[model samples]
Target: MLALASFISKHHPTLPITLISTADAASTPPSVTYRRLPDLAPPQPPIKNPVESFFETHRLHKPNLRAALVEISEKSRIAALVLDIFCNAAFHVSAALGIPTDFYVSNGSPGAAVFLNFPTMDETLDVDIGDMNDYLHFPGFPAIHSTPSKTVVFLCFGRRGLHSAEQLKETAVALERSGHRFLWSVRNPPGKGGDVPNLEEILPEGFLERTKEKGFVVRSWAPQSEVLSHEAVAGFVTHCGRSSVMEAVSSGVAMIAWPIDAKQKMNKVFLVEEMKAALPLDTGEGGLVTADELERRVRELMDATTGRAIRHRVAEMKASAAAAVGENGSSVLALHKFINDCCGRADG
Candidate 1:
């Protein structure tokens, strides 16, 4: 939200802008004053319960957040609390203080779709989430086509401590040998030659160079929004993080969910079976996929008939997302409402 904060500051300089972050982020930019809070660390192997996870993260930082709130509430005439929906404690804090609050789903439409319970692909034991079977069968959405078969695609792992290097390599090799074109965003950490082997060295020999044309391998942080918006990007292999989900839906991209941490699994369920815009991958025992299986699925998804249908549906979804945020759009109206409600006037 730093980008949003910056935009707001530039557009409305008279508004007092104090950003609350962790102590590590105390050296924030000049336009915004930084109030340091505590940091949060997640559990190893990660937990599946979203409620439990939320409390744990907040517990680490709540004391500092409360202190910041106390100071702000006492000194300034606070207007409104605009918060990310995932930031669970913000709502309660604002309510306790009787401040008007607006929840912002930073991840956008796809993220919002999950929250709203859009229809999704069906799941059976052993088999991963298949391609879109129908037009998601949701209200306000037109009937779109679904693919028959899909690849056993696994997306990028977020900072949720989900997939290990061993697992990533294992999957990559399987896909490569299977003749399946895998599109992956493999970000290499800073510095070379260390305790952990880099992704470049971990894959099978000639794995990347051979599949250079077929597979899309982005080495650094990709312009995810743009990539998802591309025609070639038929299925999204995502960590099922809110931001990624939003980008995919906003761009009309389908998904292959492999939620790592946070409320990702919840998001996975919402998308795969609920939203119908994506399929789910198994976080099964061994967490390994064979090359033959990977190839069969990837070919199934990329086939002419399957790819074409998904493309059309995604195109429609793209329009809906655009409309949602367009001028006088739903999200725009919501923003206006929030502004008016908070400031008591549009001009403010």
Candidate 2:
């Protein structure tokens, strides 16, 4: 959102941009005005489950968001209301005020976005998503294949307690066994008594020393976009989160899909089955992905034949994505139409 606001300010200096959210905007750009909303929901306890916490916060933010929209609209004329897909509550406010509205899917893939709409579209297809052999083909996209590249970045979970301690331990062991140069961003799990532990305490003893030359384990948040853009990063092991997928695609990095949540599972299907831009990792019997499997997949993704083919395919997607956002591109034209519709004229 900040990036978009910065771009608009550069191209259209007279236009005003306002950001409304519960997050602190202490480091926001000068061109953007940040409006903090009051918390209407009760204070939440320390989050133990990241997925459940996300939904809980979303539900709590709805009433406060509606109130903020009302206040903002009354204070100034809102030409158009742009909202994230998760914040569907604001749609009601937009409709009530008769304001134009558009949803922003944080994921960069328009194909993935369209695939998500399939459930709401015609229901006659009758394809089982659980079947690994069942292939999905999107219009104007190549057939999906299970292939990826050499150097990989495993970030299936964010800097929070998304995975269990056992899962984290297994992941550390897998990275150590893979023998591939990797950058793993790991966060401490929610403490038993609200006290976060050091990396050494959280991970296996001597794990860092053993892999220090071959791997980089980041304890806090990582600059994901910057890291993906690096030339050495050829493939991504991701949870298929929207923003992470967007960063990977925009950077032209292929993926090893290891979806952990429902929405991420959908995204994995679109990328791996519908677009062939990624390889799917199979958890062994009873869905337990052993270190041996992880090591083998890493080697396959970094091998000469399979990895090279996936890189070629991803390069094509990168070019197409770039073209779509370029001058006179489809995305550029759509933006023009949206702006014209909302503001009625460039001057507004």
Candidate 3:
């Protein structure tokens, strides 16, 4: 958003901008001045996945936002209102005020297409998502395969967070001897009892030392788009989070699905059974996978020949994704049409 805001300011300097966010969002990047609005204080007990939780929490600043919008519209004639797809409630306010609005799912277009196709997916495949063999022939343009070892693995949780401290220590240990290159996000290491712990103290002893050259541990919130686009990322080990899925597909990276909680498990099943774009790791219900399981799975994805083939197919999908946002890209056309209808013209 900062990037987009900066681009708009630089390329269209005359255009007035009013940035809005929760009070908590007020911080650096002081260049883009904003009108802080009333945003719900996040829940006292942090939800495991805040985004999902936020949607569940119906409390909104729309009334306050409406007043602000009305004020702004009165002065400058409000044009287009671009909103995140998950914020469905925004439509009500926009509709009430007769304001034009367009939804933006920053993830790739493929994810959006898949989300729309959910209702049409075969109901017979609704059972618990089985192993790679059970899903190797799943539906969709990109096919799946049963491979042995893999080269690169992309890791991120659907909820965007670290696993338990014990889980991380175990994973680090397993990766040390596996000899496979990994691109994992330990963005924030698990803290002790309640708060975030000092990362150095939490990491398994000598874990970083051993994997120093072969692995990359992102200690900060990652620029996922940039990382996925990097050539070294061959296959993504993901929780099938919509955003991650979109980013990976946009970059044409194969997947190894290891979904944890809500929506994710469902998304994984779809990708493996209906999308045929990924391999789902098996973990019996509520039985947390051991380090050995993670190691074996990672090795299979990185070194297997079939896994290499999956990577190739993913590359093709990546091209398709790029085209969707390119010159005549679906997203590009959509934006153009939106601008024409709301802002008056593309040139404007």
Candidate 4:
């Protein structure tokens, strides 16, 4: 959401954006002022259903959000009130305030598709969600400095994917055994949020020294898109977050998809089965990939015939993505049409 606000502010400076979010973002642009809503209390009885829990939590914030919107609008006109895709509760509030509402789905079209179609799926499918396997519908370019590209695998789990110490050890050992160059971004495990990981404690002893020549571990975070576009990165071991998937596709880097969440699982199916641009990473108990399994998968991604096909497919996608964003391309034209349509409506 911050990214979108920043983009609009940069491109359309005349339109000042007042952002409403739960927390303060880092390095927020001056053009967009934050109108934060106080955090809501945790759902009572802890709703078991994620969908119900999500909506209920947001619904509780309607009063405060309404008050804020009303207050903000009194000072200046709100062109549109954009809600997070899950925050449908805000629609009524926005409507009452006579503010046009739009839902922002930060994750790309694949996530959006599954979310928008979920209602139909729930109504149609007789089987439980876990048992129903048949339907998974799925659908960033950074500048590069001139450097010779080499063969290196890039590994990054998304922000929400904090691996256990044992998982980290297995991943490190696997990268070492694979005998391939790699860049791994490691973070503190769950519950140790915000603390920088002590790499020495999380990984096997002497692992870094052994693989110093072939591997590098980035603590906390990595510049993923830039790294993916680097000449050395041949494949990505990803958690299949929508942004990561899009970046991989745009960079033409094939993947070893190991999804960490439900949304990502949907993306994995699309990448592995539908797009044929990635191979699935098999996880065992506790969702940990053993050293041998990880090593084999890495080798398969880098050297096998299937790996060749995956790479070829993603490379083609890269070309398609470039064309879509180019002058008068599909995305460009669609964006223009949307802008014109919105302007026409506003005029009326």
Candidate with the greatest lDDT versus the true structure: 4
Location of the lowest summed lDDT over 10 successive residues in candidate 3: 126-135
What lDDT does model 2 reach? 0.71
Overall local distance difference test of candidate 4: 0.82
Point out the higher-scoring one by TM-score: 1 or 2: 2
lDDT of 4 by residue, 27-124 (tens): 76888888778877663677899988878878888988998998888899988988888888889999998899899898986567666766785564
Instruction: Write candidate 2's Cα lDDT for 121-219 as tens digits.
Output: 345332333211222344444434223333555554654425556666788898888777899877666553343446787788899999999888886
lDDT of each: 0.62, 0.71, 0.68, 0.82
What lDDT is reached at residue 258 by model 4? Answer: 90
RMSD, each candidate, Å? 24.7, 24.6, 24.0, 23.9
TM-score of each: 0.48, 0.53, 0.49, 0.56
What is the Cα-based TM-score of model 2?
Answer: 0.53
Mark the 10 consecutive residues where model 4 has the least summed lDDT. 137-146
Q: Positional deviation of 276 in candidate 1, in angstroms?
A: 0.1
On a 0 to 1 TM-score scale, where does candidate 4 land against the true structure?
Answer: 0.56
User: Can you write out model 3's per-residue Cα lDDT over 239-324, one digit (the tens) per residue?
Assistant: 77889899888877788887866788899888888767787676644545667777777776665344555655576677788898
TM-score-better candidate, 2 vs 4: 4
User: Which parts of model 4 are misplaced by more than 4 Å?
Assistant: 1-148
